[model samples]
Target: MAKVQVLGTGCAKCGYLLKNAQVAANERQAGDVVEKLDDMLQVHEFNPSALPALAIDGKVVTVGTLPSPSEIRQLIEQSQEVEE
Candidate 1:
C-alpha cells in the first residue's frame, strides 16, 4: 500500500486535496493511506511555509498547489513502480 500524506493545517484547500487523494487512490486500487497531516513538524520537511503539499511515502511531490487528478494518479503509479 502507498502512504499518501497531504500536509496542511485545517484549510479548505487542504480538505479538498485530502478528499481527492483518497478518491484517486481508490480508483487506482492502490490501497493507499490518504491522510491529512496537520503537524507542522512533518509539514516543514517539505516546505516550512507551504500550506498544502502532497507526499508519496515519505517524499514530498508537490507544494502550495493542488494537483490534477491525473497528476495524482501518475504520482501513485511512479511510487508503486519504484516499490516494485
Candidate 2:
C-alpha cells in the first residue's frame, strides 16, 4: 500500500485533491491508500509551507497547485518504487 495523504483545509480544491488521490490510488490498485488531513494545525505539522499538499508515507511530494489524476497516479507508482 502507498499510504497517500492529502493535506489541506476543507476547501473545494482540497476535496477534489482528496477525491483524485483516491481515484489515482485505485487506478494503481493500491487498495484504500488515500487519507485527508483537513486540520490546518496538523497540516502545518506535516509541512508548514503550504496547504493542498500531497504526501506519500509521511514525506511531502507536492504542494500548492492541484495535480492531475495521471500525475497523482504516477506519484503513487513512484513512491511504491522507492519503497521497494
Residue 80 lDDT in model 2? 80
Report every candidate's CA lDDT: 0.85, 0.85
Q: Where does candidate 2 stray beyond 4 Å?
A: none
| Number of backbone collisions per candidate | 0, 0
TM-score of 2: 0.90
Checking candidate 2 for backbone clashes, the offending pairs are none
Q: What is the TM-score of each candidate against the true structure?
A: 0.86, 0.90
lDDT of 2 at 17: 92
The alpha-carbon root-mean-square deviation between model 1 and the true structure, to one decimal in Å, is 1.6
Candidate 1 residue lDDT tens string, 1-84: 889999998799999888889888888885778888998876877773567889998888888888877788899889889889
* Candidate 1: residue pairs that collide: none
lDDT of 2 by residue, 13-49 (tens): 9999998898888788758478899887778888647
Which one wins on lDDT?
Answer: 2
